[model samples]
Every structure is written in C-alpha cells, then in structure tokens.
Target: MAGVTAAVSARLKADEARRPGFYAAGSGPLPQVRGSTLPVMELALQITLIVTSVLVVLLVLLHVQRRILLTMTGLASALRNSG
Candidate 1:
C-alpha cells in the first residue's frame, strides 16, 4: 500500500511540475492580508443594524399612534354621552 501511494505521489509531482508558469519558491507564497475585509464586513453589518433599528422604531411609533387614536375616540364618545 505504501509503495502504491508513493508511486501516485511521484506521478502527481511530475504532472504538477510540467505545468506552465510553475515556480517553486523556498518560503512559498506570501500570506494574504485579510485585515481590510474585516472592516468592510463590519461596516456592512453596522449599516444593516442601523436600518433594522430604524424600522423597529417606526413600527413602535405606528403602534403607539393607533392606540392613542382608539383611546381618544373612546373618550370623545363618553363625553358626548355625559353631555
């Protein structure tokens, strides 16, 4: 089994080396700087949070307005009955 694995690995190495523009560096490729992506993603998340908060505030305001209107109408009818 080990011999078969070794043969397969050798074949893969040979095939990879034959490809165009292939160069083997000692330290390999440089590490990607993903620091920029973090801030951009954070900004997007913040914007979404702000928009969601605004919508929630608007919904609460509308609900309060509806309740106030119902209460005022009830009060007006009671006054009319008493008068």
Candidate 2:
C-alpha cells in the first residue's frame, strides 16, 4: 500500500517538474474580489429597512384595540354620533 502511494507521489512530482508554469494553475476560475461595494452599505440597508418598517408599524399601533383604533381612524363614526 505504501509503495503504491510513493509511486503516485513520485509521478505527481515528475509531472509538476515537467510543467514550466502554473503547475496547479488555479484549477478553476475564482479571483475577483475588490470590494467596499458600498453606498454606505446601500444607505445602511435602506436605513435598516426604514427603521424596521417604522418599528413594525409602531409595534402594530401599540397593540391595536382602542375600539380597534377608533374603527381604523374614521374616529368610530364621529365617536358613535356624539353619544
């Protein structure tokens, strides 16, 4: 087993020696990295996705229910027709 390994290595060494340049020749394409690719990290990830989507819509309008936020801002039909 050892002998086989030695033979393989020897062959590889011989092959390398025969080669004039780029013996291992970057076996593939991977050499393009010039980055600070920034518009301030794309404006800081669009201002952290607009401040976490306006802090998750102000924490879901501070957890809903003021009569479902005055029936979604129609001011619950003018405060239920002014009592």
Candidate 3:
C-alpha cells in the first residue's frame, strides 16, 4: 500500500541521515598508502582481473569439446561409483 511505501521511505531517509558515510558519493574510505600507491594497487587489481578473464575465455574456447567430454565422463563415473 502507499502507506507502507511512505513509511519505508521515511525510515530509509532517517537511516541515511544518521550515516553520512554510508551514502557517500565517492569510493568508500581510501586505504592508508603512500603517494599514488592506492591508485596503483587498484589499477593492478583491475588489470589482473581483465587478464584473468581473457585467459579464462581463451582456455575455454580452446578446450570446449574436451572439457565437455571430460565433464560427462566424470559425471558418468561418479554416478556409476555411487551405486
């Protein structure tokens, strides 16, 4: 109902007002690092993630059929052993 929505909105507003940091516009508190270390660390993490994702995609593409066959064989072996 509209009344419930209004109450929820009011509660959220009060909560936000009570915690300014919680609704901060910028990235939450920066780590205690010297000079540009923080940005460098963040960039490193981003690059690592991108490279990892690309490698994973390439690996999957290169072994799609082999992976599928191995998965099915493993599943069948598991089922057979379970009986």
Candidate 4:
C-alpha cells in the first residue's frame, strides 16, 4: 500500500513538473507572519468604522428629531382643545 501511494505521488509530481509553471509560489502553505499586519487594510477598516459611526449618529438624531416634533405637535393640539 505504501509503495502504491508513493508511486502515485511520484507520478503526480512528475506530471506537475512537466506542465508549464504558471503558478508563482510553491504548492505549500504560505509563510505565517505572526506579528505583522497589513497597514492599508487597517486604515480602510478604521475609515469604514468612522463613516458608519457618523451615519448612525445622523440617523439617531433624525429619528429623535422627528419623534420630538410629533410629540410637540400633539401636545400643542391637546392644550388648545382643552383650554
């Protein structure tokens, strides 16, 4: 069984070797960068967070303003009707 597996593996490797090398890197796992991070990705995420926060704040303000307006109008009509 081991011999069959090794033969198959060798044949596959040989076939791969004969093919045009279109791939740039080796067929193994990429090197890990434990302490490193992409600066551009971080900047983009931060900007997105800031924009999302601003949009949320604006939406909340608009919602609260509309509610307040509705309440005030209702109160004014009630006061006029009562007095």
Question: Mind giving the per-residue lDDT tens digits that candidate 2 earns over 1-83?
Answer: 99999899777867875775424343465334466456678999999999999999988887786658767677767788899
Best by TM-score: 1
Give me the runs in candidate 1 sitting further than 4 Å from their true place. 1-35
Q: How close is candidate 2 to the true structure, as a TM-score?
A: 0.27
Q: Across residues 1-83, which tens digit of lDDT does each residue of candidate 1 receive? A: 99999898777767656774443343377445655586789999999999999999999999999999999999999999999
**TM values, all candidates:** 0.54, 0.27, 0.38, 0.53
lDDT of 3 at 2: 100
lDDT (tens digit, per residue) of candidate 3 on 1-83: 99999898777767865773355234466445456566888999999999999999998887997888999999999999999
**The 10-residue segment with the lowest total lDDT in model 3:** 20-29
State the TM-score for model 1: 0.54
Write down the lDDT that model 4 would get. Answer: 0.81
Regions of model 4 farther than 4 Å from truth = 1-37
Compared with the true structure, all predictions reach lDDT values of 0.81, 0.74, 0.79, 0.81
Selected candidate, larger TM-score, 2 vs 3 = 3
Candidate 4, 22-77: lDDT as tens digits = 22235675445566566668999999999999999999999999999999999999
Error (Å) of candidate 1 at residue 28 is: 19
